[model samples]
Target: MERISFCPTLAAPLNKSEVASSRNDKSQWKTKENRPCLMVVGNDSAAAGTLKEALGEWGYDVVAARNGWEALVLAGRRPVDGMLVDMDMPIMDGRTMLSELRWLGHQMPVLIMSNESDEQVHPQLLMEGAQGFVLKPPHFQSLQQTCRKGFAK
Candidate 1:
């Protein structure tokens, strides 16, 4: 049988306290403990919303940022299990944000999402410590598998 974790509705009106309580209740659901939180960064609101939905459905706590600077701020507040960054963000590009995250001593893996999925971009991004690259309109299978592996407990 397939395993399913807790993923509340994206449009749900639950307050933060309710969500936090649910997250802490291990035995409440027959799911694993400590599902990873995801921070998604992109300038496109639509894409960000879509990914937010996907990640939420995949049973991850989802947070969306419109740019790298916002992502950085969110990342600094708490250690997230994974990140999905869009290369063309305002103020800071994906590469720059990635480097800054590294400089801040963050060891979390980053996945870049962009329109241009050049063959060399993956290698280049990886060289800067990014874990992987996901092309825009990410494949569901790839996204699920990568996130699972990225957040393996």
Candidate 2:
């Protein structure tokens, strides 16, 4: 499969072994700690890794999913304090996932990230239950602030 690169800060795409290691069952992830747990849903492994690292530096325990379906499964199994989701993903898109999350009563704050320039999507995402919309190649500081605000809700 061709690896799709999305986030601009990717230094190198994760090799197959790295990707497999990251996919180990949730038992290996530390989610029950005092730090907030966050779910990051994105198709690009490298980008998600970078984001996860940044979130870790900011004192969050992060879990990752490759698409919306995987995210829903993880959320059903465990709770996340917040989420950062890429709006355009294979299998299931962010908008649909947001709607499903709300319907299923997973009210955690979600921040939708997308590269699209559609001006109308922002408001629609908010209506669908996203706490905020973040443009692609997000500023880490801004994302941190947004996550903090989301956690406050």
**Any idea what lDDT model 1 has?**
0.72
Candidate 2, 1-153: lDDT as tens digits: 755233233334323333334444446545566688899999999999999999999888899999887787677666677899999998778887787667555778998999975788888888879888778888888988887887664
**Model 1 per-residue lDDT at 78:** 53
Residue range 6-113, candidate 1, lDDT tens digits:
222112222333334444543433325456778899989988888889888988877888887677666655557779999997777888778767755567778888
Clashes of each: 0, 0
Computed on alpha carbons, the lDDT of every model, listed in order, comes to: 0.72, 0.77
Instruction: Give the best candidate by lDDT.
Output: 2
- List pairs with backbone clashes in candidate 1: none
Following a full C-alpha superposition, what root-mean-square deviation does model 1 have from the true structure? 11.7
Q: Who wins the TM-score comparison? A: 2
Worst 10-residue stretch by lDDT in candidate 2?
A: 4-13
For model 2, what is the error of residue 68's alpha carbon versus the real structure, in angstroms, after optimal superposition? 0.3
